[model samples]
Target: MTLAASRQSIPDDIWAKMQGRSWHSDRGCLPRKNLVFVTLPYLNFSGATVEGHLIVHLDVADDVMIIFTEIHQSGKFRIEKMSLVDDYDGDDDKSMFDNNTSAYNCRLTRGGATMSSHGRGIAIDINPVQNPWVKGSETAPANGVNYNTPDKRDAAFRRGAHGIVMPDDVVVASFARKGWKWGGVFTTRKDYQHFSEDGM
Candidate 1:
């Protein structure tokens, strides 16, 4: 879908949700500026709309375009839910890592020194189960610990076969075009599901 159509696709109620200038203490990740809810043409593996809050920035819109285009091009079909992780079980990574899509959760960084990009509304996680976070020997979703390989041969990480987004996928280029960075390219740890304005 084109960018204009994507913008038009958003309904009034959904747009309403995007409004308001109040802080959600429960979901502390709301950005202090340029915060708005954007309903992208993204779909879950089952074909549901992949809409969520994003910073009011061009990069965020472009990133949505990439996800929308990549899925349409891949011709893959499967069952899944793309949701804000915080909505599922607060900030729990274990519960959020199972094939969910989310952005803007108010929370400290993984190491706790500072707020994460998500907390700033500039980062997102797509299909966390397929693109599990790998830190040393630990994986966010303990069940996905064995599916760490970037190789598409693994059913969990398979591209068109199972809806996984790999490093080489067009989705990466999509975000890259907007100056957004992919966590899959992180040097210290691999957060395959993550993408952000600063590559956090």
Candidate 2:
């Protein structure tokens, strides 16, 4: 489907989860689809605020509705329980910090060397265990660079494909249609389940 159609086709449930959240255009960019990239306000483990962005593939109106639903259901629904990782300090080197140290436990990484698109608050990393970074060495790389665990090697593949896992494809597609890029497609390695606002 065309990007525009995809954006318009966001699930009602997801759309209702986004409402009243302030949007900063300077921090983000709009893509070909009806997607609007916006910065997200997040709190770090140290109680510091980190700003990031995600290229929301769904229509703003629909997402607003979804946000409302998420808020209304809050503790009652599993889908409504969105958790942010504590390691991201929202700094420009979040990727470096997250990858090099266990501080962030390799939960998330900054997109690039400078202020990453994530720093704008429009991107996200769902669950790390289910989407562990693929690295070249025996241990996870310190730079947050990752490759997808081979489906055969990854025990979560079955659960991931069956929807019992994180990094849902629909969610990824929703974001991608808006020109957001998934880290799964990284050249050196494949993240298979990572998504981002960088259209690259």
Best by lDDT: 1
What stretches of model 1 exceed 4 Å from their correct place? 1-33, 47-79, 151-160
TM per candidate: 0.71, 0.41
- Scored against the true structure, residue 40 in model 1 reaches a CA lDDT of 47
Candidate 2 segments exceeding 4 Å error:
1-81, 85-112, 138-148, 153-155, 159-168
The best candidate by TM-score is 1
* Predicted structure 1, TM vs. truth: 0.71
For model 1, residues 1-200, the per-residue Cα lDDT tens digits are 23221433334454344433223545543433445455544545656544433333334655665555555455443325654343454454743555666775556788776877876767877767767788887887665655676653255543344556666666777677778899887888888878888878
Candidate 2 accuracy as TM-score: 0.41
CA lDDT of each prediction against the hidden true structure? 0.59, 0.35
Give model 1's clash tally.
Answer: 2
